[model samples]
Target: MVTSPEEMQNEANKKFCVVVGNTVTGICTTSNAPADAKCTATDPGKVTVTSVPSDHLTILGTLSTTNIIMANWSKAMWQSVVNRAIRMLAWGPLGSHFFSAFATVN
Candidate 1:
């Protein structure tokens, strides 16, 4: 799990591969929040998983409600994006072998 903001900052310059078996058809990065992540498949599709930045939060009143609302919206948006990406890949030319690699990476 992601721990610090510095980790996310460092990940900004790197591409974390999304592996299915031995194939790497996508890359991803974690956000400032531990539970948040974003992935971009080679099929040119993207997916995001959102999370609340608890570091910036307090046990407040209306703010908590707002945060919950925002989190829900983000979750919905993430699901929609991920679904679109999956649908695109499922119908794309690379879908069948996207998870199968002919060679190994050292």
Candidate 2:
């Protein structure tokens, strides 16, 4: 039984490669987790699953679904960084110049 979110995601990572049945999908990589559970990926795509924490109890015979949202965690993170940089530029004296530079790269 997994006690924390980290352990839960680790288990999910092991199963990520199996999301597409017996075929190998993407290369599995550890990434950010969900608010309530862990998330991992395989190949170029990610497969997310939710698990009940060891400290939490659930009734038997309940159905649980694993919804795979197609979003690149790494890309999101970099986008966040880029947003912050833009904000900094907008707030500073050199805001216009740097903001234009960053925008042009997009």
Candidate 3:
């Protein structure tokens, strides 16, 4: 995990791998990733994937939302938002399932 600004910069400099059919097709960086490739990173880690080749919609959705949340909210604030959401869903029939599926950052 990246623990400092310098580490984050270094991680950003690293090339992202682009694979197809169990074989690597190319390598790219944040600035040059293909239009179809979605790349996202937080202080802790990064994720990159080709949108068309991958069928993991849940992963894509989580990555997108997590990136947005981390970009806009501090840890404490984010936790508060999550807690509020949990509370709001507490009375629902799907409360347990929602809580289990909800993502939280450490």
For model 2, where is the 10-residue window of minimal lDDT? 56-65
Ranking by TM-score: 3, 1, 2
Number of clashes found in candidate 1: 0
Regions of candidate 1 where Cα sits further than 4 Å from its true position: 1-73, 99-106
TM-score of 2: 0.23
Q: Rate the local accuracy (lDDT) of all candidates.
A: 0.47, 0.45, 0.52
| lDDT string, candidate 1, 1-106, tens digits | 7559786566553446666676554445443323334454232233333343455222322212347655566655655655666566566776774432222111
lDDT-superior candidate, 1 or 3: 3
* After superposition, candidate 3 runs with Cα above 4 Å error: 1-70, 92-103
Cα lDDT tens digits, model 3, 44-101, are 3334333433343233233235476468877788688767766766656656433234
For model 1, the run of ten residues with the poorest summed lDDT:
97-106
Q: How well is each residue in 1-106 modelled by candidate 2, as lDDT tens digits?
A: 5379877666545533323454333333334433323233243344444443434232223222354442334556556766786678777776643314343212
State every prediction's TM-score relative to the real structure. 0.24, 0.23, 0.27
**Residue 49's C-alpha lDDT in candidate 3?**
39
